[model samples]
Target: MKHVRLLILLSLAGPAAGAEGGPLVLTDLAGAYAPGSLPAGGGWLALECGPAGCALRSTRLQLSRKTVLHLDEFRVPLEIPRVKGSPLALLHGLALSPGPVTRWHGAGKDVDRVADQLRRRGRWTVPGDARQLALSWVRLPEQGGFRYHLGDGTTRQFLFATAFEGHYGGDTTPRVRWAGDLDGDGRADLLLSLPDDNCGFDDRLYLSSLAGPGQLVGLAARFAGRYPACGC
Candidate 1:
């Protein structure tokens, strides 16, 4: 029970919770893994498959420096492979040629609209061939006010953020820290910072290849950077 509880704490640890700062951790919003690296001199790899963190020696893949672990499991690879970890942001499936990055702090009267900002920039591309990724912040008129639709696009629009609540509504502000082809699908994949007054620091990864029947992209993973109020 103590081990299980310790694992849970590790998953949710943040600056406020006495967590020692290291590289930024990217996790499957729905998968199992841990945020730890092997000893400094290129040692064996271990994967904390569960909260218990019962790591089995898996096949090792050569890496240049410290990295986040990726393993097939004990039976498959003799060791787990690690990718260079980042304290700011990290995501899998991202191909070269990083996408254009944009930021919006958010507000009521300021109105330095994110939509207008991207439109003014004109072009945000990914990879050498450079395919244009559609980006928009569509506002639809509603009964009381306008509803917001924000996302990227290819043939169809891929929404990562939306707002129906009025000006006073408590909605998390969506900030796009980076955008690119993480899935290599020639469509835009986004890494967004969605922070709430109560929810703490939350980063999300969206991939075009994982989209369901109607979505242009689907949430593939997440990294909870910090949490001050404890998520219930």
Candidate 2:
């Protein structure tokens, strides 16, 4: 198997941390992998941003004579073998305005609140065991949403769809982070941050369990009326 290296290049005007003390604002986010090694039909996945949000966009990829894949909003699972001297390479890039930093904080009472809302809204059902919860990030044209896999590891569900007021209705991007094990449930949890309708960011906490159902809670109330340092 051939190993691949990743290179990230980011250009910003100010320090990642602003004088006001907030998340580092990134003026430019761009990078490439195996720059000139990919085949002629291969190209880097570029980031597209507008009123909607930022997402990875790229043309289709011709993996082989019999394999052609479209890199659209839908997810395509592919398993590529390491062929010595192969010309295939992976690349990606992104750019965002300077703003407060966003990250996952972990599972907690707030996550439980979100989970309750999901149940009330008929979006999700509490699993029998908290330890069965699983979390992952997903992108879709209608709005970026998170994926929750039940303990069975095969059952999956969408948690929520986020859209900013002025952005394209279906182009919202979802940003999720792993927060390790929280709530002392012996299960892993997640943290999500997405652009809200007001153009500000909304933060949510989620806890996954192996012995119980999953829980999601929102932390926006804690910063009521206060705009997140970062904007959509």
Candidate 3:
């Protein structure tokens, strides 16, 4: 079967409310995608909008069509927003990797000590056939997001962190879990809980954003159920 990568723009019912009467709608805009071409197994869908009004109405980016025979990687030349005043060029396609694991402490030790200790306890193993590991930390009564440290236990490292969107901060320790290949080369994704929320629906999944061994995307989507028992 020949796989064709399609771009679908879907809009919820009702007229898209915008400054104007209706929002600019963009539907089934097919880009230069090789039909029957398989996309990167662990890749992501990149949404691009031109410099103008835009809205999606029941459209889907059918990347599955690009995967015909054997599974492969999907690389789409998506034109995304450059800097405030930079020339626009085709940015590399979005790639997907395993997620990150999170960990919180109860002893209330300092963050520096916790990170260092986790680094010391970092485990290295080649699962399946991939290489790379990331270490992230979540400190309570302070920040909500984790600091992502990329690279092996050796040297030369890259580090970054994703803080909460707004002032809503953390007051308690967040129990973290690792999601990735257990015996392979995939990274571990994470599922976290935010008990501080009074409403009880603070659980969320941090999806992989960047296409690398270690790089955590912001809150993918909220998880089901309200906040469960604090500990995990």
- What are the lDDT scores of the predictions, listed in order? 0.39, 0.31, 0.29
The RMSD (Cα, Å) of candidate 2 is 18.8
What local lDDT does model 2 show for residue 102?
20
TM-score ranking from best candidate downward? 1, 2, 3
How many clashing residue pairs appear in each of the predictions shown?
Answer: 10, 23, 29
lDDT of 2 at 50: 32
- Per-residue error at 12 for model 2, in Å? 30
Best by lDDT, which number?
1
Return the lDDT, model 3, position 72.
25
**Which stretch of 10 consecutive residues in model 2 shows the poorest summed lDDT?**
5-14
TM-score of each model, paired residue for residue: 0.39, 0.29, 0.26
How should the candidates be ordered by lDDT, best one leading?
1, 2, 3
N/CA/C clash count, model 3:
29
User: Where is the poorest 10-residue window by lDDT in model 3?
Assistant: 8-17
**Model 3 misplaced stretches (Cα beyond 4 Å):** 1-134, 138-171, 182-185, 207-219, 223-232
Candidate 3, overall lDDT?
A: 0.29
